[model samples]
Target: MTLKSVFVLTTLSLAAGCHGHDHGKSEGGKEGDHGHPHGAAAAELPGQSVTIWAQRTELFMEYSPLIVGQETGFAAHLTELPSFKAVTAGMASVTLKYVDGTTIVATADAPSNPGIFRPKLLPQKVGACELLVDVKSPQVTETFSAGPCQVFASADAARKALGEEAEAPGRITYLKEQQWKTDFSLAVAEQRDLQNGVRASGEIRPVAGKEARMTAPVAGRVELASPAPLLGTFVKQGTVLASIAPRPSAASDSATLAADVAARQAEAAAARAELGRAERLVAAQAAPSKLVDEARARLQVAEAHLDGASGRLAQYNANSSGGAAGRRFQLRSPVAGTLVAIHAVTGENIEEGALLFEVIGLERVWLVAQVFEPDLPRVQGARAAWFTIEGYEQPFVVDEKTSKLVTIGHVINPRTRTAPVIFELDNKEGRLRIGNFTKVSIATGAPKSALAIPEAALVEDAGKAVAFVMVEGEAFERRPLRLGVRSNGWVEVLEGVERGERVVTKGAYEIRLASASGAVPAHGHVH
Candidate 1:
């Protein structure tokens, strides 16, 4: 969250990623010099070490106090933020601004080792200097301004100004090199709302008003549209789905239908004109508003008759021919969606009002949960929910943004002694199926605000819930947690970690393996 001046930039709650390559050779051509993982700079840096967070990157830097005319080595651990991965390739420059306008700058072409960029500065001016770091990677160009920095005249002056400090106890060294090499991530333990949850068996279903069923309009044989719709074919509303040719009958003549449509059109136009005239007269105060309302009603009735007449004529205009046979009726989808089901096949004879096609929108879906009658009282004030499906390790969350509670059904099943609680969820990713069975965790009860970390951050050690709290860039502390109620991917921390502390979330397993290996810090990186 914060840091101070010097030849470094880093984030407080930082986890590192492994470098793509580390050849283990220092910049000075020495076997274990400044560039090597076992370099002299690896020893506990004597001056200020801070972690700073910028918009696009996190910098964890350590430097032995900067002395005039002396090569000052800075262990600049640069991690790309949000993803919390090490910066593999980039140019990192450290600038020290003096009281005068001039400055001292050091540059590193790439990571001294991946995630660690060593930029050495030889100061010419011995006074307090403002520190700034500029980094240019393939993905980002970011700068960080750390607070005030100090430059001493000599080693004695540096030693006297900042004395010795003790290292933290029980430090577990998990180097930045190891972090970059694995699937690692870091997150801050912050206050979150934790609630008691109720578990229920649920089924995914189509949302209301997003599905439609197209049926036969008359007794006829079916004729599918060109490039006929198959199951799962996406179709838009009012699109021609299929047509039904009625059996030969005197009343089903196409010419008669056309004549009826023309008559209906003329009647509709006359009614529309009457309504316009009535409205204008009412505005002029020459006619009562009741007459205007009656004319409007007559127009609506006429329009409805016209629609029916037009539909009959449209059937003949469609692909159906009524030579010696009756007219054909067209069946079109009323809503936009996928062709989920088709009950009739092309050229198949079917009766009027028989089911033909079923279309249902699936962009969003509903999870209908059956809550036990006894638990109804507890779930009345539900706050959030999560559901687990097959093949998914992480459960999908159901919150106000992504989902809504449609209803807690009033009617209870007499046999099952349960009520249906429906939750509508966005399914733009097509993850949920119409008939998927899922186990849902419905958060209920009053919310409790407490410090919490991701459930993935925890490691079961000696039968205790433990997590690796990031102590610094290259160090971590295995803290045993006293956990409270767990819900929706976060575990409440009753103890053992503080607010704003970063913990490893993704690679905790590998970090635990590193701890068990008992490898020296040199085995990992030059920390």
Candidate 2:
């Protein structure tokens, strides 16, 4: 499997079970205003006559053109007032009737854009007021009532009123109604191969099979008869390491020689007597059978003694002739491996069964892994797996012969709370080390395709999981979604989005802030 990046950082995907919040105003704001649930600045103005013009839209005019002049006493009053183009480019004259028996008349250039209108004067009555707008255009003429007007004498006062209005019922820009967005990304999962299934801290380990020391069976002065291998040397099975020569002291030398000679002479005499006895018995029809049998038995015993004497004498001669004064014993390697340690010096005497040397087999190595309780189930039946060594960063797969879990420690390790799970790894390629630590990953379950995205792409809004969907140019909308199984770096999107839609995969927070601030443009297609 391919990982796109190793150090990639992405946002965490909120689980489908979570929730998100919206901070926008409710949908009840009046027409032609930032009806966001959050409070916004109010419409500024002067109270006067409102009149509709003949043209539908006039560019850079004093009043909206789509509206016709309602011929009233106030409309006549506004015609005589100082006229200047309104802030909007295309507005014409329009007249409105306040419910309080007063009229406000105004003229603008055109109606290319729609916005709230405030005459440069306030109505006589206080509190809220509704006025009727008589709009006329080349195509059609329409009349509509404009609300519960919040009128103030100055811009600052209007702004304050707007704030209060925002908090009041039926106001737009409610904070609870807004939605925020975020982006997400994905990367490959890192892999490691632990051979000694998760090792726990402080687990007792016996020296490997060959690390134990083996000593000479008998005590003697040691010497190498040939070019014997020493400490740090490698030996094959049955290769002799050294030879030991047993020496004779001044007191024991003469006695050993005399006993040897006597044993030889006795053996010879006994053999001759036995041969004569057997021949005579056969000829005389039975010198008693018992006597002949006894003589033969004695002869056999004598011959064995003689053979032992000869072998010992030969050993002594070989040692004395070699500038050494003792019978030598050969110390051979019991197993094939490298000699790691030695306690014996060339001239030092060693006791029987004393440790002399240590050997190790390096052909195979162990990779130990510390299996955490949660991870144990996943690796239970894993036959083949791989891991990466820390220094090498190279991954090695467990060989089939050593892939099986050799052991699972019974007692939980108190320190690490991990159990030992061991597997053998091949070192023939020289790629693995006996004690190197590695990170491992096992394919615990079968792979299946699911709708997935980077976790970062999700954000919480009003306790719901949401992502930003890029709708029109530079415009994104918050979308609620449900999530499913996640693996590697990708989270499964179970709902609220479809494949191929460019959900914000990055810079989602900034986009959300802009939307809440009204920096985002509303689509002309919005209902």
Candidate 3:
């Protein structure tokens, strides 16, 4: 016999065996038929009906009725694979096969409930019967079959038999092929030397000696130099910032000083002429040698007085000719930095030693933290720190290579009970602004190894810390975590996750939403 014929004969034999038992009389006709009296005679035949359950392509299928000329029902439950939640949106169909090599197809309809589909089937000749359920959703299409279920005399018997073989819940089977279609990425939990740190409030400041206040050198009217310096203007050392012209006053006026210098010059000229005359007379025996020597001494004294007056006037660029142009002194910057403040404006009369400009170098900065007295020892012993400036999203790091601990205040504030702890950081980028409030964490204690993951990898699920761990290429399991110290961008994982296991990092929140909603459309790809 052919293989097809042999399979048919075997199915027929099994069906016969199923109906062999007498339903009318148990053994001695002691009881009337309690099970499906309408099909009592058929139930006596060996294999009148059967029920079976099968899961195919993520849809669950249950089939009943193995005998010919018997009505059968096929129910299909559409669900997402791995997550087994009911998929309410889909189309399903059922195909029925008979022993006579004939087939019938019917569309499945949803009952009052969603995700549950029912297709009707009535066999004409029932040596054996088989069913195939096809389900299609927007994301995928799948086919499932429970080939040739044995038909029982009653529906109750079939339900009872199928219940024993039902699948377990909470197990999902996400495929690797589908994972690539969504925004999914993973990171491995690693053993790292994480620092336990203390958090403190602080502010960014210009380092001491790195800032300077330019003051008026003398009492004068301020005249801004060309290309006037404004607030935030960067200047170099010795760059002329402004000019201070001496104000004409009774005490010391430029015109009066000029007259005095002229008078002194005239006196020096007269003395030199007198000395020359005296020397010539002595040579001709017209005067005594002592008289010539005395004239020479007097000329020297006058010349000395003239030099003193000229040198004094030169400091103000003063012109003895009494020109206002030579009466001003140029004020230059003493340091290279940005002008943070301007105390005196152009044409303003400033007094001697008055504040004019404040220049501050920003290539380096100070983070001054107000450390509580209890934590002062930790702040002093900390090897490094991470600080966040106001208005910036990222934290700036300060380590031995780029920073140093400059001081710890000896006096604590009486009101706040806190002392200043200072750290210097390189600010070459100028991202840190002076006087801005900061949040600081100083790493303290000895270095110790601990399992940690990126802070981004953590998410909250029902108020518990959760992370997603990749069990397979595409399958992920939600893990509750016990977190320890958090330092820098990493958080120590005290429990729930293991070292070397890949966890979702960049898209952890996305996964959490998917797991919560039981529906995840295509997400962005992780590069």
Candidate 4:
């Protein structure tokens, strides 16, 4: 054979050998690769691993568009999840499955805030649904399910209903506000106080003419012959309280009696002689008319003297026996009332003008209260007033006529710097006292209805007031609010918030913190 032919045949045998070896290896690799692309196609397909940061088992969740409010930062997280393999940006949907076998679907769309997935309402029912995710995978044939989402409308509400496990990460739950309608108190606007007023402490006091005192008119010993039964007793008109027997004036009585007896005896002797002379003069016809007249006049004078003597004797006898002498007069209550104080003792001598008894009529009582200078203007025009006593929390009506502003003191109290404003109140029940402190609220003006919210829902930072409103499920956005008057625990929301919007009331502090950390996303609402 020639040299060129020998070389060509050797090369041909080597080429065949190389080809056979390549064929065997390629066939073996093909079998081992399964259905996956051998080159770029397998690498080009998306890759993702199932990751559940945390699981909150059996959390009672509500699934509704209302749950996906504007405040929740849920949109950003949903959009970011699409970056993971097998998940597309707009293809994802979240559903809540309640323990009671109810379901609600939530869809993701382009959020106004970049990269945030604005949620579209799939339904309005608040229940539960399984969240299934379908993504293209090279190694797997079936789609992946995200297990169960513990969705809730609010963190605290969910925690209260489903316990602490509901707060687990990535365990979104919906809080149902079933109690929102019922668990609220209404501030109905009627004729109630509007502006702020100062509260001042004060007490009721007794006015003059309402209080009375009884005293002895003359010095005398107290007698037990009072018509009233007891010492601290009540006496009406004409009821004798007590009487004192007089001590005898013996010398004056004896002088008056002697003068009366002597005068009476002389008058009797003169009258007998005059009658005898007058009868003889008339029978004999010897006396003149003038003499007869004179005799008759003398007899008339004697009889007049005797009558005077008899009256004087009778007066003297009564005085001598200590019956007509200075004696204790019965003391009676000048007014009909309750016996409050009794100073006179049984069988004790009392000086004239001394205090004997004190009585008070409980038919009406004054309700005095202090008014601060600042609040005085508002109260001055109050048509009605109300007050509550310590023991009685029930407020009673105070009419303007019965409780007018009697006086406003010129001097303010040194400690309180408040003027003592007295209003006469009619406490016919006698429940009030001279020094019982009372809580008074005056109906100074008419009431008007205004948009209002609980003060707790507000977040005060610097001078601005803000509130976190629930947007989407478990997400909240901070919103500025214009505030007006505040009464009790409620504040009137003048602007930036409307009625019926679900707002973050309890967890505002935490929401603010989340917002500051950028953990909360500002997402616009679709519903």
Candidate 5:
């Protein structure tokens, strides 16, 4: 016989053996006794199965042998219908009621395997019976019923009925333990204020007046401050960054200027002495008062000359103390910021006014979003925005409360036909860097509430957007989704999923692969 025929015949025989017992009392028959062996019911019985679907909780229940005087095992799997993700923890109970007024109740707690519950129930008499299942989860309590079913005298009768029923296909069963082993995660689909907006490309730039260029003040050789500053180095305003000293050819001029300063100092000292002497003579009547006044005038004139010479010398000493050859001008940071560029290296000869270093404060930055000419009108109406930059997992938000719209360009670029719309963002954490390419969404319309999920939950299947939902605790169903506005890290779900459903937010592709490859394991009791 073929394998399929052999399997069927074997199952049928086992079913017949289980139910061939008499309906009368056994040798040890007591008040609840029936002919069938009680011990036999505890063992696995072939060809006897019944499955019940709980619509409220989306729980799927399957049991072996709807036969009296036998121990039946009911396996219940709980899932969230909307997302088709498994329900991991819940309390379950199964009550069997027979027409003869005999009732049996069995209870099972959540298993480590997740979403799978096994309850053992034993029926005492063969008659009409009803099965009632109650499941309690953290979110809700649900009850379900199956069968005003006939509790047959034997397993054979139960198997015969089961053979006529059809089984569900493509039902993937993943246990809780298995999920914990894999990179599985879930999130609730929730109602949120979704803003429909225009998407535009942009870049991060330092806010105006927040950046400064350090340039060489005079033609000289560069000497970097200790721990030479490089790109990305933080600096404070007034901190010396480098010193410049005049070249060899200009050393003589520096010396002459120094000599001139000394000459002025000597002359001012002599005049002050002469004025003191003249004032004493006038008091003693040895000199006229006019002579004393003339001495004082000479002192003032000499002091002015000294001041001018000192002023000239001070210019060269602006940065650092003078050396033997010339004064070394110390270049200090004009603003507190990070050094983003170094145009001149230490010991290199640079001409006056040459670019030296670029410092940019990162505490705040501007997002210069490029709005196409057609979308320029919408940009003016934008009240808020969220932007994502390359290499960042989270988006930065700008709203009227914390950010300001700096400007909207009146001129459009000839090549791209796009205008720059500027918004400033607080980057106190320094997570954002200048010149990073960005994608921005400017909210221009009124906010509306809708169901939404993380953008990561979405995947494309056969050219249609789909998401895996936990229908039963261990079973995930592939669902097609109709998507709407996308903003930040979330996408609006117009259809395919309901609020409260748990969808796979991580490792969905693995589940899809497992389903496609028929690698999903059978659901059973976990030790």
Candidate 6:
């Protein structure tokens, strides 16, 4: 079996119990949905049917009464478990594993239809033992048990032993064939403790202290750096985005300031010379010490004048140069973020207070919602809140670990009668965009415990919300839902469904179509 599975699975053969999902486009009815029932292959039988579940396969067989030296036909409906799809191709063998170690095996090469396999067993001896259906294919090899079955001694004895079919009314008969071919799934209903909350309209925003506005510190012509920091560009703190060439003025002209610095330097040199001469004369007893002191003070004043002129020249020259300088101010990003806006352009001369650029950190964003004034009290005490955006069914949770409440406005809008409520959200996935409209829910009250299911499970039929609850392996019943609170992709069920009961979650539309047509496909195999 291992060697066979290795060769079959390695070849990736779809010829076994496995099949390609795409058969062809459907003609548009239940007949087209799961494939039309294999009516021609089915023939009526007298005895009861047995359905059993194995690790990987489900076998539902309808077989005739067993008797010695008599041939018994078994119509095996093989379905793959978990997926609930048909085992389209496989070799099915029905074997009677007797207590005394004797066995009778019947073999069918392939399914009469996709999920139907017919096998015949000739019991040479009568016994009470396990009925095992073994399916072998490149895709799967599984043996399903129908538990203990009987092989009668004679036909009259068989009639008395297998009495009569039980009364089966109002039991919706969905064949395993239909379930295997259609989109199908089941979800267990369970008790959930959900927080009660109120809904409000909201918008995504950049969090406070995460956004930085860059402006010109002095009146200058804008000069952009290499790879101009365009809108939507990510930048780091102190990354030079552009430079500003200060508009020259008469007082701060580079040439005039340079000349003033030279004159001041000359004055300082002459003062130093005079101070040296005064000190020499004082040492020779030709002048007073006060004259030397006065010379030293004059040199200090001249040097101070030189430094003042030099400072002005550097300031006007953009701090780079006095000899050849105009680019004085280097505009840099104040924070690490995406460059969201650019107000100034290259070579544009602007005032000192003119706006230049805007950068905003998008790693974390704020969800701002407006609550009705009457609902403001509840929002103010909210411990948790979440918001849903387009393209996402579940709301993003705003918790203390990744996010927190930023503020709840006390002031109410006079015209709209709403107050602003804000929550900081983790936008690490980059799903939340600023200015995006959203639906928000804030949990203000205590948690309410009740049975619930996924919001996707409910289907509207004839203006009533209904769910298909599984009754058996191949049966389902519709139950109208009595709804209560809904939050976080789940809806609270007040009535109509019990906890632990399974309901159709996926491929529910097929069930709806089946129910509406009132067609239970023929048991598509012979006994």
Which has the better TM-score: candidate 1, or candidate 5? Answer: 1
Tens-digit lDDT track of model 4 for 287-392: 7667667777877887778777777565445322233444235555566656777676677876656787776655566666677767766676455556666776
Stretches of candidate 5 off by over 4 Å are 1-170, 173-178, 227-233, 250-317, 341-356, 522-527
Residue 413, model 1: lDDT of 98
Candidate closer to the true structure by lDDT (higher is better), 1 or 5:
1
Deviation (Å) of 468 in candidate 5 = 1.6
Identify the candidate with maximal TM-score: 1
Tens digits of per-residue lDDT for model 5, 107-197: 8776323665667777777778777777777743677665455677776666555453332456555554456556666777998998888
Query: TM-scores of all models?
Result: 0.67, 0.33, 0.48, 0.35, 0.59, 0.60
By how many angstroms RMSD does model 3 differ from the true structure? 17.8
Give me the candidate number with maximum lDDT: 1
Model 1 poorest 10 in a row by lDDT: 11-20
lDDT of 2 by residue, 358-417 (tens): 666655655566778776766777665556655552346654775555665676778877
CA-lDDT, candidates in order = 0.76, 0.45, 0.63, 0.46, 0.71, 0.72
How many steric overlaps are in each model, in order? 10, 100, 24, 31, 16, 1
Report the poorest 10 consecutive residues by lDDT, candidate 5.
1-10
lDDT of 3 by residue, 1-527 (tens): 00111011111112212212221222112442222223544333222211221232334343333334455444454545433345556677777776666777766544213544556566554345566666676634666554464444444554344332221223233433234345554566999888888888999999887788877756778888789888887899777878877666633455565677899999989988998998899999988999788988988988898887777667545322235655666777778899898887888988878888788989888899888999888777666988776556456788999899888899999999999989888888888888889888888987688999877688888899988876533336888999998887688999999887767765566566556676423311110
Indicate whether candidate 1 or candidate 4 has the larger lDDT. 1
Better of 2 and 6 by TM-score: 6
> What would the per-residue lDDT of candidate 1 be over residues 1-527, giving only the tens digit for each residue?
22332233322211122111233655565544443122343232344666776666777776656777777766777878677778889888999998686788899898766777778787887887888878888855778776577888866676566655545557776766777777888888999988778888999998999888777766768888888888988899988888777766534557667788888889999999999999999999998999989998999999999999888777657646445445456678889988999898898998767889999899999999999998888788565798888777588899998888999989999999989999989998888889899988799877889899988899999999999988776778899999998778788999999988889888888878868886645532222
